[model samples]
Every structure is written in C-alpha cells, then in structure tokens.
Target: MKIAITSVGQDLESKIDARFGRAKWFIVIDTETNQHQVISNEHNLNISQGAGIQTAENISRHNVEAVITGNCGPKAFTTLNSAGIKVYSAVDGTVAEVLEKFKNGKLKQAGGANVEGHWA
Candidate 1:
C-alpha cells in the first residue's frame, strides 16, 4: 500500500506535520518496497482558501491509498473519502515511526474530519 504521511521536511526523519492542508511536504511510502517519495505542498500554503480540498486532490492524483496526519479538515476528508482514500488523523512522531505504526496496524483510521475547515 502507498501511504502518505504529512511532514515538516522531505525525509523519514522529519517530524510529522500536524496540519494536513498546510504541511510542508508529504512523504509517500510504498509499504511493500519501502521506497519513498516527497510531495511538496507549498502551493497550498498561501492559498486564500480551499487548501485542504486542493491538497486532497493532489494526494488523490498521486494514487495514495491513505493519508496519515495530525489533523484533517472537513473538505479534505470528504474529498479523500470520495476518492476511496483512507484518512488517519491525530498522528504524531517522525514519518518513519508513524509508518511503522501503520505497518503494524497500530494507527487508528479517522472516521471523519477532526477539525473544521481553515484549521491550519
């Protein structure tokens, strides 16, 4: 499975960014191969609005199966859900740690957006 983890930087050691829409980067890891790629989210950081929605669309286009972040807003949650992508929120620690948690099925899947829009 390909899982995206919001990050403060572009590597596994980077701390997990709590905000989904405004996260600096997303470290997408392929569980089977252990290969990783970074998706920059700079474009959405300064948007007047719709950052979460736009970010969700970007993630969906990358064929991500799931997203792990500290928080997700309503619009992004809806968009991701519609695209059959699972969202896991309230995540913490480095990208690598969280990946391990996910691999071990220790992370909980979020049922809905944990915060309202513009939460970042």
Candidate 2:
C-alpha cells in the first residue's frame, strides 16, 4: 500500500502538517518496498481556500491507497472516499510512531474532525 503523510518538512520525522493543500511537502511512503519520496505542493498558501479539494485530487493522482494525516475536511473526505482511498485523520505523534501503529493494525479508523483542523 502507498501511504502519504502531510508534513511541514520533507523528513519523515517532521511534524504532521495541519494544512492539507498548503502544506510544505508530502512524504510518500511505499509500504511494500519501504521507499520514501517527497513531493512539493506549490499552491499559493496565502490565498488558498478549499484546500481539501486540491488535497484529495493530489492524493488521487498519486494513486495513494491511504492518507494518514492530522485532519481532513468534508470535501477531502468525500473525494478520497470516492477515489477508493481511505483517509485516516487525528493521527498525532511522530510519523514513525503512527506508522508502527498502522503496520500493526493498532490504529483504528477515526471519526469527527478536530477543531484545530489537525490532530488536536
């Protein structure tokens, strides 16, 4: 499975980004080969609205199987779901920690969007 995590920085250790479309970068991890790649999101962060739409489109384009992020809006959730991609929100803590939970199936699917728009 291919999973993508929104990150403030390119490294896997970077904090999970709150903003989906305007995030600095997305760390794409291939679960099978364990290969990690970084992709830049060049949308204008200042005036960007409906970030969820763009985010969903981006994830769909990448053929991502899952998106483990801090938050996802309504549009993003619907778009991802229609595209057959599961969106896992409210995933706080380090990237490595979350990944471990995911691998072990310890992290169950979450509901309810957070107020801070991330993993608060």
Candidate 3:
C-alpha cells in the first residue's frame, strides 16, 4: 500500500502540515518496501481557489491508497473518495511517527470532510 503524508518539509522527520491542500510537501511511502518519495505542493499553496481539488488530483496521480494529514476540506475529501483513496485526518507529529501509527492500525479513517471548503 502507498500512503501519502502531508509534511512541512521533504523528509520523514518533518512535522506534519496541518493544511492538506496547501501543505508544503507530501511524503508518499510504499508500505511494502519502506521506500518513499517527496512531492512538492507549492503550486497549490497560492491558488485563489480549488486548491483542495487540485491537490487531490495531484496526489491521486501518484496512486496513493490513502492520505494522512492534519485536516481535509470537503472538496478534497470528496475528490479523494471518488478516486478510491482513503483520507485520515487530525494527525500530528513527524511523518515517521504517523506512518508507524497507520501501520499499526492506530489511525482512524476519516468518514467525511473534517473542515469546510476554502480552508487554509
């Protein structure tokens, strides 16, 4: 399984970014191999609108099975859901820490959007 974790920086030690759409980076990890890649989300940060949807589309192309982030807005949540990607929100700490929690089934899958659209 490949999971994408929103991050403030490009590595496992980086703190988790609270905003899903405008997060600075996404650390996508392949659970089976323990390998990962960093995807920059800078382009979405300054968008006037549709950041959430755009970000969702961007990550979907990476084929991540799930997304672990601090928060997810309505549009992004729906988009991810439509693409068969699960969203896990309200997560904190470093990317490595959350990855362990997810691997251990300690993280809860979000049922729907935790925040409204246009959330920064």
Q: Highest lDDT, which number?
A: 3
Residue range 1-120, candidate 2, lDDT tens digits:
888888888786888887665676888888878788887776635544666767778778887888888777766676778888877787776666777778888766645334333221
Q: List the candidate 3 regions with Cα displacement exceeding 4 Å.
A: none
What TM-score would every model get versus the actual structure? Answer: 0.96, 0.84, 0.97
TM-score-based ranking: 3, 1, 2
The clash numbers for all candidates, in the given order, read 0, 0, 0
What's model 1's lDDT at 39? 93
State the RMSD for candidate 1. 1.6
Please state the error at residue 21 of candidate 1 in Å.
0.5
- Cα error of candidate 1 at position 45, Å: 0.6
Better model by lDDT, 1 or 3?
A: 3
Question: lDDT values of the candidates?
Answer: 0.93, 0.74, 0.95
lDDT of 3 by residue, 40-100 (tens): 9999999998888999999999999999999999999999999999999999999999999
